[model samples]
Target: MQAVDVQDYARRLMEAHGDKAVAEAAQKARALEEKGKHEDAQPWRRIEAALKEMLGPHQS
Candidate 1:
């Protein structure tokens, strides 16, 4: 039997769990920033911004 490729496996995992992962990441970023963990929070903030850009603004 052949071993499964890790990147392929990760891609599948993300596809299956992407939304939850993004939401959780956003929450963690907010929590970190709120607690004065700005340095650590930078990466998450970038992720959140990118997600927001992809989502666009809500129209209602």
Candidate 2:
């Protein structure tokens, strides 16, 4: 997905899930990866990164 799409997804996920959004994205990525769905996992990884960026470095 594009950067803007990822950011939009991240924001919506954050609004819905709050602080758990990042972890949720990471978990989705990892699950896809473990299932040998690397391509599918990419977007989730991007979303995770976007969420992390939105949360800032000070967050756990």
> Residue-pair clashes per candidate, as listed?
0, 0
Largest TM-score belongs to which candidate? Answer: 2
lDDT of each: 0.60, 0.94
TM-score of each: 0.52, 0.92
Scanning candidate 1 in windows of ten residues, the lowest lDDT window is 1-10
**Global lDDT for candidate 1?**
0.60
Candidate 2 minimal-lDDT segment of 10 residues: 51-60
Candidate 2, lDDT over the whole model: 0.94
Q: Give candidate 1 regions above 4 Å deviation.
A: 1-22
